[model samples]
Target: MFPNQIGDFKHIINTELLKSGIYIVKIQNNTKTYSDKLIVIK
Candidate 1:
């Protein structure tokens, strides 16, 4: 994950992303929060 000071950021989820399953992604910044569910198929 890359850190951002201007309320902006970027990330790449390619590492260890070969398995097929359900995954959860979460991000937080100050009083803001984010979450998502991802489904992967082989």
Candidate 2:
């Protein structure tokens, strides 16, 4: 696992560890859900 700094409340994905590609990101909580596509270029 990589290191992350704590903020209000969120996911801090370290892009430096990801290669050039397209990925899907999704997150859901008690009353909400979120989704998005992430593009990483190196």
Estimate, for each residue in 1-42, the C-alpha lDDT of model 1 and write its tens digit.
333333552222333553434333344555665644354644
Candidate 2 TM-score over all chains jointly: 0.29
What TM-score, over all chains together, does every model reach?
Answer: 0.26, 0.29
Candidate 2 runs further than 4 Å off: 1-20
What's the lDDT for residue 33 in model 2? 57
The worst-scoring run of ten residues by lDDT in candidate 2 lies at: 2-11
Each candidate's number of clashing pairs is 0, 0
- Candidate with the greatest TM-score versus the true structure: 2
lDDT of 2 by residue, 1-42 (tens): 533433322344545446444333344445665545464554
Q: Would you give me the overall lDDT of model 1?
A: 0.42
For model 2, the local distance difference test gives 0.45
Deviation of model 1 at 26, angstroms? 1.0
